[model samples]
Target chain A: MSNYSKVSEFKDGVKKGIPIGVGYLAVSFTFGIWAVEGGIPLPLVVFISLSNLTSAGQFAGTGLMLGLASYFEIGLSVFVINIRYMLMSLSLSQKLDRSTKVGQKLLFGYGITDEVFAIASTREREVTAHYMYGLILTPVIGWTLGTFMGAAVGIILPERLQVAMGIGLYAMFIAIIVPPAKHSLAILCTILISVGIMCLIKYVPFIKIGEGFALIIATVAASAVMAALAPIKDREGDAHE
Target chain B: MNKEMYYFVAAVVMALVSYIPRALPITLFTKQIRSRFIRSFLYYVPYAVLGGLTFPGIFYCTDSFWTALVGTLVALIVAFFEKSLVIVAAAAVLSVFLSGLFL
Candidate 1:
């Protein structure tokens, strides 16, 4: 894609990803409220939501914070929970044009969460810088505004409702996973492995690794195993179509 | 204003850090892939990450193992048949709520 076309494509891509941004806003707003109710300072809540930009990591991190966890605990927790992003970046690194500057690759890589990565990777042609920027704008704005709004309006929200807000993230996860599970045994097995491992880790006393670290190990290990076991056959020009 | 300002600053810094990873690739990479191994790798990354992320999210809500288990099973069942996000969420949340009542 030429420079001018990349700019045009960016606009088009932003339009496509707006619905996702809206969904994120709904979820992040709830997260902000949860953070405030947990006694997190509004700024801290905003920081967490903006910095992490991940429902799972921020959720786990807040769970720790509310428990008065140590700094090491918080860092370790987010690290484990977010290790999957490293893998996502690694995988996505291959799709970029080789000419992509290292700085550009590194910058765009930081925001590659589950939803953003899914939307960006599905496009047939090469992903342009402009398009990625456009995609990030709506989600970034939505998430930030949601967090700020949630924190500002925190006084009215009840604990019960805060817990209920969790359903938004859960719902989004379900929406992403269900269709693929129906079509592919490989996917179902992957899900089962992840859940089973998580369950055993959560319950089994001897194997009591902390949740964040456990998440890191489980997701990376399960994904690597799945990838090794069922290598996908490549289709011609599928990525660029 | 003091507290809010701090958080807003924190947000900008974090956002800057986060945006780098997400926007970098799209800005720089516009090249075609000619390698077979690389192509297959990209295709499967989404599926793998989706599976990895989804499975954990379903059961990680709390220590109420049975309730979470039941709720996730119900959600997965509803979700599997092409349910919408709202429907799947309702299934999971209601399942958890109802199970909480009994268990």
Candidate 2:
């Protein structure tokens, strides 16, 4: 009975992960093309996707590296861009099944991307290590495979097509934030504040900020302002509640 | 370090910074967060980060400003109604390709 249940849970997770895997294939393909176009070697590009499995962090980090930014800048930018995963990890830790082992938790914790966390946290039952593993498998494969394919194909892609595809990543970013911002005033304000800061740093001669530092400042300043102005009400399982 | 070596090292640094935030919280902390301010900051940060990265940079993505603008508008419209990442991305790319012919 235990074996049957575990198998079913793993299967369920794989089923849920399919759509996310398909999406990653498209996005990571773009990442591969962009990174290679920026002069990153094909193998290293694939390695970045395999190891990091993040969209924004990888893009920002690669952009910095191509520009020969300092290691400090790369580290700080990636950290700030990815710090939200910590919150998702915290939320997922509480939802993990009590029977899950420490080793299992640590291993699967590495797989907690935004999409994975969203699916795992919303499961009606406690998330099992098996389920997490199954959920991570397809997306990881898609991300890595897509990178490899894109890097290879990018070499032969025409310059005009490459330029057109340059808009792919930013377009995806628009797709991500637009729906939510349309629904919520706070989100709209957050986006506007960040964009305003970025513009100042770009156009204002006196500002003089590095690309990595600019991103960190904009992200922190915007998030801090929105958080202070509109604190979220405590929900169930919150310590204060 | 040579250029390739520096690139590899940078990739490693990025991987470490990316992994630590993800692994540490789940491995070390089990208790729910009590602070509303911290919770709210995390909640709002991703959107702000995405916004900061997209704009201005998106403007410079293509050869001409007009192509990028048209692509951005198409992405926003498709994403507003469709909500599929691939479709939104594809629509924008197609729009830019078609517009690039004339612009």
Top candidate (lDDT): 2
* True contact recovery of candidate 1: 0.33
Give per-residue CA lDDT, model 2, range B62-99, as digits (tens): 88999999999999899889577668878988998899
Q: Each model's number of backbone clashes?
A: 21, 0
Show where candidate 1 strays beyond 4 Å: A2-8, A30-48, A56-77, A97-107, A122-126, A155-165, A234-241, B1-43, B60-103
lDDT of each: 0.63, 0.80
Could you report the DockQ of all the candidates, in the order they appear? 0.30, 0.52
Local distance difference test, candidate 2:
0.80
Candidate 1 lDDT tens digits, A58-129: 787677767655556666656666655665665565555455566656655656777777666655566666
- The TM-scores that each candidate's chain B achieves against the reference are 0.76, 0.73
Among all windows of ten consecutive residues in candidate 2 chain A, which has the lowest summed lDDT?
A: A232-241
Give, for candidate 1 chain A, the lowest lDDT window spanning 10 residues. Answer: A155-164
